[model samples]
Target: MAEIISDLRQDDVEDTVPGGIAADRLRSIIERIEKLEEERKARGDDISQVFAEAKGAGFDVKAIKQLLRIRKQTTEEVEQLENLVDLYRHALGM
Candidate 1:
């Protein structure tokens, strides 16, 4: 992969576009980006399927997503946020 990228870069320098950037190089870069975007979409579909399976198993998808977000934060950050929520709830009498 590294060799392929290096070769592409080498060929790119020889075929400059109007603004000094090689047209081939620009095309290569765009193609690589497009391929990655397609892969990302496929991965997103896979994740959605997993979420559907979890829902079918009786899990609450919304709460699961919230838990996923909470797990991304530090424990101290979560505690601080929860404390703030509790304080706000108390003030609101809810």
Candidate 2:
């Protein structure tokens, strides 16, 4: 991977893009990318962060973005649960 990246960097230097980047400059760019990759890896996630969130939330992501869609809780159920919570909180004079 490092060799391929170095080759690409050499090609990029030869095929200069506007500003002239020195070899050290290119190495710095590669190093920054590598550091970002390492940080991302330490967090145990891919470059995209949605997977990390899903993992943290204990989600099964086989369904893809289907999980990102919010499922509306039944209004009746929500009210009932809220009432139960209120009752519980008040029972202890909270």
Candidate 3:
């Protein structure tokens, strides 16, 4: 299995030009993307931890998340959404 993997890597090297600049650039781009993805995952975990702490503190996590979503929206957008919700509620006698 090790020999097969080595052979495959050798074939890949052979396919690239002698200078391998393109291959090196591609590798660098891929490594940077992987690093960013890892960082994003860590940040997500931190966010989840904060949410857990909020829940433990007796805050409603769902409402907090909803507020965060609303905070990201513009005032005009929120008013439009609220109007739509009110219209729909009235339609349904809610």
Candidate 4:
């Protein structure tokens, strides 16, 4: 894949000026970024499949997502968020 890109941009690589941008280096960076983007999409799809499986097993997907979000936070942050929710609920007479 990289070889094909390099072959197509051979002219750009050869025509690079001294002290100017390096075409080959730039192409390498762009190719790496594109590869990472593809991997990220694949991982996203995998996560969606897992969530679907959880839903099929009769788990509350929304609560699972909330748990995931809370797990990423500090304990103190979770406490603070819970306190705020309680305060709002009290204010609303709930």
> Across residues 5-70, which tens digit of lDDT does each residue of candidate 1 receive?
455556576797665566776687899999999999999999999999999999999999999999
lDDT value, residue 76 of candidate 3 = 100
Query: 1-94 in candidate 4: lDDT tens per residue?
Result: 5554445555565645664455676678899999999999999999999999999999999999999999999999999999999999999999
TM values, all candidates:
0.83, 0.30, 0.78, 0.80
lDDT of candidate model 1 versus the reference: 0.87
Off-target runs (Cα >4 Å) in candidate 4 are 1-19
Q: What is the C-alpha lDDT of each candidate?
A: 0.87, 0.67, 0.82, 0.85
Estimate candidate 2's alpha-carbon lDDT, on a 0 to 1 scale.
0.67
Worst 10 residues of 2 by lDDT: 63-72
Error of 2 at 79 (Å): 25
38-64: candidate 3 lDDT, tens digit per residue: 999999999999999999999999999
Error of 1 at 39 (Å): 0.8
TM-score of 2: 0.30
- Model 2 over residues 1-94: C-alpha lDDT tens digits? 4454455545567644554545566677889999999997977655257776776788767554443432355668667878998999999899
Report RMSD for candidate 3: 8.4
List where candidate 3 sits over 4 angstroms from the true fold. Answer: 1-21
Model 2 lDDT, residue 49, Cα:
79
Candidate 1: the clashing residue pairs are none
Best by TM-score: 1
Residue 19 lDDT in model 4?
43
